[model samples]
Target: MADRDFLLWPFLETRHRDWAEEVEAWAAANAARLSEGDTDEAVRNLTRAMGEAGLLRMAVPESGRLDVRSLCIARETLARHSGLADFAFAMAGLGTGSVTLFGDPALREAWLPAARAGTSLAAFALSEPEAGSDVAALSTTATRESDGHWRIDGSKTWISNGGIAATYAVFARTGEAPGARGLTAFLVPAGTPGLTIAERIEVSAPHPLATLRFEGVRVPDAHRLGAPGEGFKVAMATLDVFRATVGAAALGFARHALDLTVARASGRQLFGGPLFDQQMTQAAIAESAVDVETSALLVYRAAWLKDSGAPRVSREASMAKLHATEAAQRVADRCVQIHGGHGVVRDHPAEKLYREVRALRVYEGASEVQRIIIARAERARAEEAARCKPTP
Candidate 1:
C-alpha cells in the first residue's frame, strides 16, 4: 500500500522477493474482497484464491520442517494490504501446523495435501471459555472407549475459522493424568456427527470466529495428532513456529498506519503550517518509525533464530511478539492522532487498521503472557548460567 520497503535487509531469497511482489500485485487487485461485508464469503473466497495462486502451498513443509521466516514475511506483507488477506495466508499454515509437526504420514498425506490444494479448510481449536492463556485449564476431554473410538466432548470458544473451517485441530483432555500432561490433539472434521457451532463470535473486526461444541464426536484413534498428554507440546510447537508471524501482522498494520500518518502529517495543515511542523506531531512520527524498525528487527531475529536450528525460541519469540504487537498498537494510535478527526471516520484506512491491529496483542499470546514468558525464561537462563560458571 505504501512505497516503503517491507523486507528489512532481506531475510529471504530471490524466490521470496518474487513471490512477495506477485502476491502484492494480486492482493492489490483483489483488495475489494477485504472490505466485503460478509465474513464467511470473504474468508472462503480469500483462502481459495490464495490456494489457487499457489501461495497456500507454503503452509505445509515438504517433509516436516516449517520455515518460520517465510510464514512471518507472508503475514507481514498480507497484513500490510488487508487483514483478511493475512488471515487467508495464516490459516493455511497455522491450521495445519500440528499435522505437519506431529501427524503420521497417512494423516499428513490426507490433510496436508488437501490443505495445500485448498480443498480443506483447517483450524486450531484449543482455547476454551476459560482457557485463554492457561491451556492447562482446558475442560475439553477425549475418552477412549472399548471400541477403540475416541469420543470428544468439549466446548471451544474464541476459535478462529469456527463456523466455516472444514477441519479443526482440537486439543482435548485425554483423562490420562492431570494438568497439561493429560491433553491430546485430535483432527476433528467440521461435519463430525456431534460437533456443532454453538455460536458465531463477533469481535472488533469481523472474522469467522465461533464457539465449538463437541459432544461425543467420535474419530478413529488414527486422527490423534500426538500421543496423549502431548497436545500441549504439539500446540506449543505450532505456536513457536507461527507466533512471530503475529508480530509481523502487527508490524504490517503499523507500517500502513505510519504511511497514513506521514501522508497526513506532511500535508494536513494546522496553525498555518503542516501538521508535521508541530513538535508533538514530529515526535510521535519519529517514535512510530523507531517502533516499526525495532519491531522488524525483533521479528526477523526471532525468525532467524528458529531457522538457524535453535532448540527453542521462547524468549526471542516472546520479545518479538510482545514488542511488535504493543508497538503496533502505539503506532496505530499515533496515526489516529496524526489524522485528527479524519482518523476516526469510517472511510479512513487508519480506522480499519486500528481495529485490525488491536487483535494481535491479545491473540496467539497476549502481551501480559509474553511478559510472563520472557521473565520466566530470563530467570531460567540466568540461573543456568549462574550454576555453570566457575566461581572466582
Candidate 2:
C-alpha cells in the first residue's frame, strides 16, 4: 500500500496500474516468506516463489518485447514491500537481459525459459577486479580453439547472484581489436569445467554476491552472444533498459521512508502538539513529496521513451537513475532526521531504507558517472545545435 497517486501520471496506463496492484498484492501476501530464512537462502526462496507465482514471467515474456513500464512498475511495487524481493526480481531480468536482446534463437530457447521460470538462476559477469566503470580495462580473455570452442580466463567481481546462478553471461576479451571492441559476451553455465566462485562478497544489506574465476573455461562458439565484437553494445543496450527501473526501485524506497516519516510526525508529540505541527516539519515533508514526484517523472519518462521505440535513451536513462537515486538517499536521510534517535536503530524501516538506498547510488552507474554522461550528452546536443544554426 505505498502511494498510488504516482500511478495516475500520464506516463502510466491502465495495464501499468493493474500490474502494480497485482505485484503489490503478491508482495504483501509473501512478505513473511520473503523476510524469513537465512539471508542468502531467503533470496533464493523468494526468487523461486516469484517464479512459481508467475510474477517473473513478465520479465521474459513470450512476446519477446520488454515493456519498460511493466518492469518499472514491478520493481517499484516490490521494492515498497521488500528490497530483497525487488532484488530477486531484478536480477532475474538483468542477468538474462543480454541474452534476450542479442542471443541467437537456439540460445534464447535454451536459457530464457528456465530463467523466466526461476528454475535456473542467472548472473551477469562484466565487472572484474580491475575493471568496473571502465569496460575497456577488463582483462578477461577468451581464446579460440581449433575445435571452434572458446577458452575464458580471468576473474569478475561484484557480480550479483554470482554463487547461486546456474548461468553467467560472461564478457571476456576475444582480441578482435583493442579495448571495448575486443570484448565478447559468452554464456557460461555455472558448473563448467574451469569456472569457480572464488569468494562471496558481503555488504551492508545481505544478498548473494561473489567474485568468480575463469581458468581456461571452454564453451562452444555457439554460446557467444551477438557477434564476436558486439559485447559492449549488448551490455550498453541491456543497461539502458534496466537503469530506468533502478530509479523506480529507488523511488519505492523513498516512498516507504516518506510513509514512515509521516506516521511518526503525525503521532509523536513535542511541546504540546504533534511533531508535524511545526512549520519546519511541514517544509521537510513537502520537499520529500516533491522529490518523489520529480523522480517518478524522470524514471517513467525514460521508460516511456524506450518503449516508444527510441533507439537510444542514454541521456534520459542516466538522468533518471542519477536524480532518483540521489534524491532517494536525501529523502531517506531526511526521514531518519524526522524520526529522531529511533531512525538509527537496527531493523527500523527508516534504518533499513538508509542502508538499502546507499548501494543504488553506487551501482548501475555511479552518481559521478551519470553526471559525466549527462554532461557529454548536453555538449553533443549543443554542438549539433550550433552546427545547425543559420548564418547571422
Steric clashes per prediction? 0, 0
Q: Model 1 reaches what TM-score against the true structure?
A: 0.96
Per-residue lDDT of candidate 2, residues 249-268 (tens digit): 99989999889889989999
lDDT of 1 by residue, 1-392 (tens): 56446453666666666766877787777755654768888888888777777777677766688888778777887888889889877887889999999999999988787788766788999899999899899998899999888999989998889989888999999867788888999898899999999999899877779999999899999999999889989999899989998998898888889988999999988999998899999899899999999998899889989988998898899999999999999999999888878889985788888898889989988999999999999899999999999989
Candidate 1 — what's its lDDT?
Answer: 0.86
RMSD values, in order shown: 1.5, 1.1
List the lowest-lDDT window of 10 residues for candidate 2: 31-40
| Local error of candidate 2 at residue 255 (angstroms) | 0.5
Error of 2 at 364 (Å): 1.0
Prediction 2 global C-alpha lDDT: 0.90
Worst 10 residues of 1 by lDDT: 1-10
How accurate locally, in lDDT, is each candidate? 0.86, 0.90
